[model samples]
Target: MSLVELIAQADERGLAAAGVSCLDRCVPLLGGDDEVLRPLWASLAEDGDGWGERVAKIRGHACDAATGAGAEAVSGPRSGPGAEAEAALLARRMLAAVPAERSAGALREWADTCSVAALDIHRLLDVADDGNTSVTDCREGRTEGMPPLVTAELRRQVTVLELLAGHGAAGVRQALEVSAEGRRVLQAVVSRRARGRT
Candidate 1:
């Protein structure tokens, strides 16, 4: 099934996982560490307890990190030229927009939004043009000529949703693993960009 179809049929947990997975992969752009989003992943593994509190805590941390107040924050290429800064802004916006309510409807919307934002972030940072103007089109399955970064991101997003749908709560760990891999890739891209600028 297409990602849109998978998201439309997903349960509340699936939607939350999808959204969180997107944000988790983009953490590098927000100057977050590899494990910065672990609390959110752990919340997905258990019953829906303290989910709101975890999100709130992460939001506070993300805000502080963006402003260079958080100790865990690592300065990266996101502070560089136009595309890098824009990508960082999009990543921060994804965290800031997390909804307090974990309802299926709200999560579905957030998941859709995060998917687009994550794609946009990749497109901005990608060395090659993805050849598409609208990320909405890519999400809707029109992905010919996609750049490596965007293609990998789209694949990861779909994998995360499929894992959650097929395994229910059992999939959160695997989804998190997928996200971690993507985070490492983005971190390398950020590092490479930083080195190139020096």
Candidate 2:
């Protein structure tokens, strides 16, 4: 099934995992370490017992990281930091916007939002054109001639939802592993961009 269909049919846990997985992969843009969102993943394993608290704690860490990156970088569009800063802000917003309720309706909205935001982050950081002007088309499976980064991101999104749907709670750890791989890719891309600027 398509990602939108998968998300529409997903349970509360699936939706949460889907949203968290997207945010987890984009952590590098927020200056987060590889394991920064691990606690949130763990919460998913236990049926979302402490999701709100974990989200709050991670948001705190993300705020600290974003602040250290510089208020100018995150707050100003014309200050010359450009796409990287914009991507960071987007990633930060993804974490900050995570739903406290974790209800099916709330998580569905958050998952859809995170999916778009994560794709936008990838598009911003990707050096090549992603063909489509909006990432929404790519999410809906209109992909053709997509850039490497965007293509990989779309694939990751599909993989995550499928894992969660097919395995239920058993898929959470595998989802984390998938997200970790994406995080490393983004970290490398961020590092390459930094090097290019110097």
lDDT of 2: 0.83
- Per model, how many backbone clashes are there? 0, 0
TM-score for all predictions? 0.91, 0.92
| lDDT string, candidate 1, 45-157, tens digits | 88878888988998988777777412233344433466777777778878988888788888999999999899988988888873355677778888778888998999999
Model 1 clashes, total count: 0
- After aligning candidate 2 to the native by TM-score, how far in Å is the CA of 44 from where it should be? 0.8
The runs of at least 3 residues in candidate 1 whose Cα sits more than 4 Å from the true structure, single-residue gaps closed, are 68-80, 130-133
Give every collision pair in model 1. none
